[model samples]
Target chain A: MGVSVLQPGLATTVQDVGRPGYYNVGIPPSGSLDQYSSLAANLLVGNAEDAAVLECTYMGPELRFGSPATVAVTGADLPPLLGGEPRPAWESFAVGAGEVLSFDYLRSGARAYVAVSGGFDVPAVLGSRSTYALGSLGGLEGRALVAGDELPIGDAGGAAPGRSVPEALRSTHPRHREIRVMMGLYDHRLTDGGRRTFAEATWRLTTLADRTGMRYRGATLEFRERVAPFGAGSDPSNIVDAPYPIGSIQVPGGVEPIVLHRDAVSGGGYVMVATVISADMDDVAQSAPNNTTRFVEVDLRPGRRARRRRAARLEALREALA
Target chain B: MSGAGGPGAERAPTVAIRSPLPGVFYRRPSPDFDPFVEVGSPVEPDTTGALFELMKQFFEVPAGTTGTIAAVAVADAEMVDAGQVLFTVRGS
Candidate 1:
């Protein structure tokens, strides 16, 4: 099957799971920010969990199908239409040859995923089909979709049998406010008051938020004072460089918390005080501007257990549907 | 007045290293360690002298020039604005 972009919205790119094992070379694993929704859309269309799909951001693209095919939409609830008729998301549907599929401005979530019966036939780069825009690698010329861009699809014989996503597996749309996080690698650098403010105060998402990271405006966090000795004399000093990970919260100059995302740099010298759990990453990714977020601490062992349970549940649901 | 130029000559513009984003600024690599670069030390482009952490992501700001560290404009653990001067490097 063949698909062509008519109106390329805000930022649309092909993405799958991601390219891991390249962090040591300063290359981040660029993949779907919301893996849950991406996988759901793929599975609904009978595609493998890692099949490449279109990741639409904020706005979505207008597409035309050159041949009959099965497709599904998931994530962010962007109202998707097939040939001028509204279609439900999270379920597979067949499209006639020469049909036009379009998505309107997102009414909810910041991102949406579209999957075809046979995944998008884009050549993979370094073991991934996802786009990393900054480095100008992967996807369609390493950038967002543009008008007139034709996307090839693998031969899938035709539309597969209809499939339904389990109600329990279907994600309830996340709230824009209140993100959960666990204390991170550099939590010790924060002063007692700094720690209290982080847990107690609510932060407002700023317009500066993006795929790189989310910036917040709220209470300023402080670090314990230190002494810097130059030659012989010691001058008062505070602030240190440290490692970071996805969901790390760093308070530079003790002000404004920035939450790193999928495209965040691999390393830097900054105090990373906390990391948002993986379960909560989807919620953070979908948060719109001006949303309020609060940090919550959880123990590692319990957190790991919760993650395992969630994974098992998702796998079971996928197997039943398959 | 001290130069050999004619009267009413304009003074040279003061050069400064600006902050890339608004956040807390630090000079040292860690609490228990010495800073990567200090006053009078030479720095080259791509030199990772310091970093700024926002939320939890740390962004490294390159020196972008080969020069002697002239002065430290922002203090350790001081809040800074994007594009605000953080250091003054005299080109070598």
Candidate 2:
């Protein structure tokens, strides 16, 4: 049976690992902002790591189950409630038929993932069940959840309640974070002092943050004065439209710095100063507005090592749960 | 807690209004506008006292109980956590 939406929270949508190999056609790889959290929720519920789960933003949704099922809530500190009683996050719990599941106020982080016993049974588009709301592409009708909407649940495969990730392997959300980046693409566009400020000065996360991009405010960056080349705009920060990789940092008008995220447009005309390493993308996703961040530069070798360490942590999580 | 009043009447208890989500709390809708409420301002259950900005979206924080504003707890543009008290009202 399916679940009925009693009240859709701030921006709840269904997401999975994401759809890759479609950026060449202007479609972004829309997926969970915090991939580790999403995967952890899926594994806890005995579903495939790529199974679709509900992504709740700062707020959470209220739903009524149509049948008995196992459920788990992960990512953020949003507390889950079953039948109006408190339930631990990051651990599986059982919900009976017609039971209502809700959430308390978010205590930390920016988003939460909800995984049912059998995952959400939405049809996949472009090989993904993730929602790209801007393009109306995938997920439940290519939009966010609304009141009265019924979400289908797949067949459960032996998931049990009380399974939880170890505390050591769980992620933490802090008010201030230091994110590592690789200074390469278009770094020459900025002056030496500008580069130092980018690395040294603390940047505050602005309210203009979402799945597509995150904007930061702090010291103003100065671009090296240059004559506009053919096809490039007159602004010193402009470049002939180049492909934007996920986690790339771009500054427009030398003011606010923006980091492209999972649902970012494939190509843009802004000058990219640095790229956040893949290992730290989850950290960036968890950042809330008003949080402070500092950028640290790293080389390719260290970046690759961090990625490996992250993978190892995931493996540890799997082993612990097993 | 009750304060003595004439003929067995007691002082009204103050109710705290907390934010529903974490964000930057603003007293005004924008920089150019006046604050939505101030101390001593009367309010209905649906009255909005402040706005919380999250991911560039503004959510109005409504007063859930009919009361008179007794205190404003947070300053404009201050970062607040979820369930943080924003205002205190004395029921009418």
Candidate 3:
């Protein structure tokens, strides 16, 4: 008797596959900004690739199903629907009891995930039920999916509805996105025409973005005037605070840049300049806000072979949804 | 309203609504309130009908159908995005 919420789109939360170690003290590891389409919607709802699910941004919530479940709708292309008909999106679909599910509108990526079967039980916190709604920490109670709430699910795990995750392990989102990055920590505080205007500008993604960082706006980058040090603040893009990493990038007055993602806060003081490469943090979480990225500039052995080709495309989408 | 084959020649279904996210939008709920469902009123299905905002949070926008307002399509504070539309209900 769970999955309730009736309209909580635009930022619906819950997510999973995050909350790693606690970032020294500040916390920031929210989770599932497209973790390969939230692990192919938990392997097409049979669950267990980190469970928890939901995520939906660029709109899609409305849920209902207080009984029969087995859902799936992976990242973006935002289509979903069930009691209202039109289903299929990264496959797997069933719902029933009071059915509903909903969503439509956002064509092409920006965040969608969903999953359902047994996951969404919501509890983990530091170990990760992953919502981190700005540190309120872990799913549900931490916030986001509003309208009536309910959620609960967690029992079934054998509902693989049709499965399907192939199309080359699916993951496209592109209205121009490039992404990649690697450069250096604080990128030597910039120069060399500010890291060539931070790896030759193009940026854009800005409506500020969400899970904590994204900002961008076509490059003004330049930094490198130096002379601040002791506690470093005088903005040559500051620095001295450290940590960040999830996809880092920072830039501050050098003009816009931001990129941090997955609820990042872990550490700051600005000055990052480059990092983005955990196999393109799911292409910077499906990019969006006006999309138009481009950071490029890799190395670190092609960012560890693009994170072992995104872990062999999530182990071939868990053996093609097993 | 069920037309396409008789009765008063029907009509109603209009729907639209949109703007589930990207900021600004707002048709009131503040700034000395009042604007929530105007252009002909009625609304219902969970109510609220407009308020997106962003970065400064806000959210609401609901009006999930059961409608009447047939036209508001954004303006007060504008901005919109994430599907756009903003209103045109008629539905019921």
Candidate 4:
């Protein structure tokens, strides 16, 4: 007994914390865009934090449950509907056998995570159920869900319904966000004005966002004039191929800047001016098309502190759910 | 910016069609395509009123009710917020 997909959402795929320690080998750590939200959904359903969950994009799927199970929806503000009745987000609820579960239009944020009682019982690839659709690696046959696909559910557990995350601890997605970044990697390549504009300008996210990377437009960045190196391309922003860290910001042609995400290519030739702070990666993931972002530069001290704060928040969720 | 109680005030009862998600709203599916709806255009509940490109996905926004397009609320390719009215339709 499992969930039957009636109408697959825009891009529903199975994902967990991710398959780490494999980036050097060309496999990205493909997983949920917002790990905290995913973990919260899993914890609320009494599943392990790394249990595979459905990562729904702008739209959500229409599913009919084959058996009774506890369910939770978190991340985006996309509300779940059970048998056409509205259910709250960030809270665990129940679905009876044969009940249809659907979702309303996304109200905020860009992604939502759906957690089932036993999690989606999909075979793990490279120790992860996470889907890297580009390479067709994991999840159900390694791609987004389609109609008639029956997702297997793990053995039912004792997670009770009505458990909800505290409001204060919940994630909020505003239209305009100020994301913090650590400047370094290729900052020296940008002119003074380019650096100032990058720090001061408000960039609007373009529709070129996916698991791979998110592209933004607004102010144009100027690179310092330099003779082309033998190994690099002629474009001022080009450099010899180098490993790209997740959340790195690379501007191509000195125009649109793209921030690589969880499923990013391991190495690229573009010049990455800065990296979004580790703590703010989720925020980057939540950004929707046309949403404005002002990148605030921060030093390693604050960056590490932000990471600690995020860890503490996760700890608080664990305590509350426990 | 298309809604009732405007410069000349309301003359007829109209219904507002709002965008369900935040994104760049396009009046036409693409630049080469005609606008989905226009003033005086008759529409049904399932009629595609507009499109919003979010996260590289183009999602169609249904008209939701049978009516005649009375006024357009936003310009082509305008960035719209969730729940922001995109069209006002007069019930037939």
Q: RMSD per prediction, one decimal? A: 15.1, 2.4, 17.0, 3.5
Give the TM-score of chain A, superposed on the true chain A, for all candidates in the order listed.
Answer: 0.91, 0.98, 0.38, 0.99
For A1-322, candidate 4 gives per-residue lDDT tens digits of: 9999999888899999999999999899999999999999999899987899999987789999999999999998888999999999999999999999999988889899999999998999999999999989999999999999999999846498989999998999998999999997999999999999999999998878899999999989999999978899999999988999999999998899999999999997899999999899999989887789999999999999999999999999999998
Q: Give lDDT per model, in order.
A: 0.75, 0.90, 0.79, 0.91
Q: What's the DockQ of model 1?
A: 0.02
Cα deviation in Å at residue A225, candidate 2?
A: 1.0
lDDT of 1 by residue, A138-204 (tens): 8888888999999999765234747878777776654446666778676776789988998888887
lDDT of 2 by residue, A9-119 (tens): 988999999999999999999899999999889888888888899999888999999999889999998999998999988888899999999999888888899999899
Clashes in predicted model 4: 1
Can you rank all candidates by lDDT, best first? 4, 2, 3, 1
Which number leads on TM-score? Answer: 2
Model 1 reaches an interface RMSD of 10.2
Q: What are the TM-scores, per candidate, against the unseen true structure?
A: 0.73, 0.94, 0.35, 0.94
- Report the C-alpha lDDT of model 3 over A86-119, residue by residue, as the tens digit: 8889988777788787887787668888888889
Which of the predicted structures, 1 or 3, would earn the higher lDDT when compared with the native? 3
Q: On a 0 to 100 scale, what is the lDDT of residue A192 in model 4?
A: 99
- Residue ranges of candidate 1 with Cα displaced over 4 Å: A156-161, A176-178, A228-242, B1-92
Docking class of 3: incorrect
TM-score of 3: 0.35
* Clashes by residue pair, model 3: B30-B33, B71-B88
- Candidate 2 residue pairs in clash (backbone atoms < 3 Å): none
Best candidate per DockQ, number?
2
Count of residue pairs whose backbone atoms collide, per candidate: 12, 0, 2, 1
